[model samples]
Target: MKTIPVQLKSKDYDILIGRGLRAQIGTEVAKVWSKRKIALVSDKNVAELYLKEVHQSLEDAGFDVLDLVVPAGESSKSLAQMGDLVQQMADAGFTRADGVLALGGGVVGDLAGFTAASYMRGIAFIQVATSLTAQVDSSVGGKTAVNLKEVKNIIGAFYQPDLVLVDPDFLDTLSDRDLVEGYGEVVKTSVLHGQDFFALTGKIKSVQDIREQAEELSIHSIRYKAKIVMADEKESGQRQFLNFGHTFGHAIELLSHGSLRHGEAVSIGMVMISQRFEAVGITEKGLTDEIAQRLAAVGLPIDSDLVGTPLFFKHIVNDKKNRGGILNLVAVKNVGEPVIVAKALDDMHDFV
Candidate 1:
């Protein structure tokens, strides 16, 4: 197993990447926590697939495990679901000493992390990320949130997980669409890391390729994010670079009404934003086409019919990345160099 450390001073933790790490979660958690009540949180879909083994492992390791499963989807990342989770934990008499084990993908990680962050002020949590999105992005950054009705991830906190366990074997069970959506993140990270990493992604033509290189790719992505989070944990500065495609991507997601997956929308968002950057002389002339070709090669959508709709503009205005009527847009100068541009929200219309 390869381990990447997210150095956050007192909040430091390790991301363990390998195949079959799920079976060792109990022992892993035991290393940091001992003889405590534990809550194992997962979504119905993930629970149906791997809950039995996870529960058994924790129970066998002497943890008093409590099961909490939510419905699977973006909708579950809402205030209502978060409140219900808090109520369940309260009803079970859990305290700060008892931690939460997030046992699914991004949705589960966000909900469970937020639940742990809110319950009794804050409690520790571990991330057992099953989805590629969570493994590479959401599970490591200490950014947890539930979506508001009008926007995504508007209500949340910077609650770091005690441990992050990634088992690439889980990818073998994902549907092709689910698996393809994950490549969006991989592509995003690769581009931000620079041209060489971006070129490496060009070789991935299928989910089989992603699975075969999961450990290496995951570590590279995690290490990139870890270094950024450590430098600017609160996103006040350099960390905003991570939002490269997220601003437009989130707006697209809101407009889709669940029709577009986050990564797919971001795939389109990265392409659209790259074109915008090129138009303004921030990126090279052909950077947009290069990004589109890379996205299409991996089965991700490069353009969408909703590109210039009023609904799209409406959601973009509501994005949290905006401050004082200006959006801090992340633009790429090249494969690995991203710049933050402060543009008036009204000016965003020209990009569309």
Candidate 2:
């Protein structure tokens, strides 16, 4: 097992990554919560696969575990579900002293993390991310929230987890499409960091290659994000780079109405943004095409069927990064270079 420390202003935490670390969750979690009960939040899919193992581990460690299972999917991240989970935690005798165990992919992490953040005004929590997307992206960052009717991740908080336990073995059950979708996020991280890191993706083609390189790839991606988050935890500056493809990605997801996966949408969004950069002469045409082609190779669409440029631009206007009606955008000057552009909302239509 390899443990990485994430240093934060409020408190420092550890991210333990390895194969078969699920069996050690109880002892690992015990270091934070001694006799305090833990409320575990998971979805139906993950619950069927590993919930029993987690329950047995915690039970062996003498923890009073209360299991709360929600239906799996993006739609489950609603205000109603959040309220229900909060009520469940309370009925189970939870307190600020107790911990929350987020035991699924991004949706479960976001919902449960927000619950832990809001319940009792804030409680300790641990993340046991089950998907590749969650392990490399959402689980490490403290950004937790559910979606609102009008916006994606609009209602969320930046509450850091007490610990992040990532077991790559959990990925064995993922379908081919889901596995391929995760590479979109991996590619995003690679682009933000640089080309050498991006080149590592070349060796990864099949699902087995993704698995064999999972440990190193996850650690490398997390390290880049951790450094950026540490430098600007509140996102006043450098951390914005992490949202390289997210602004456009979130808009596509909104337009698709949850029909499109987040990473898949982001893959297309990244391609679109790269094209915008090329149009403005900020990036070379070949490089932009290469990015789109690579994403296509992994089964992510580089363009969407959504029919209106103005509507797509409207979503960009609503993005959280828009400041004073000006969009703080990240564009590529080349494969290894990312430049931030501040543009007025009116000028966005030309690019879209």
C-alpha lDDT score of every prediction, in listed order: 0.88, 0.85
User: How far is 89's C-alpha from truth in model 1 (Å)?
Assistant: 1.0
Off by over 4 Å in 2: none
Predict model 1's lDDT versus the native.
0.88
RMSD of 2: 1.5
> What pairs collide in candidate 2?
none
Tens digits of per-residue lDDT, candidate 2, 1-352, equal 8888889889899888899899899998888777778888999999999999998899888889999999998888888899999898888878888988999999999999999999989998899989989888889879999888757888989999999998888899998777777778888888778888788876666667787888888887888888888888888887888788788888888888768888888898888888788888887777777777667766777887662456777778779999998988888777667778888888877767
TM-score of 1: 0.98
Pick out the ten consecutive residues of candidate 1 with the lowest summed lDDT.
194-203
Q: What ranges in model 1 sit over 4 Å off?
A: none
- Measured with C-alpha atoms, the lDDT of residue 61 in candidate 1 is 92
Query: Which candidate number has the best lDDT?
Result: 1
lDDT by residue (1-352, candidate 1, tens digit) is 9999888866878999998788798888889888788889999999999999999999989999889999999999999998988888889899988999999888899999999999899998899999989888889989899998868888999999989999888888898788778889888899898766787787787777887888777888898999999999999998999898888788887888989998999999999888878987998888889778877876899877787789888887778887989999999898888889899988878766
TM-score for each model: 0.98, 0.96
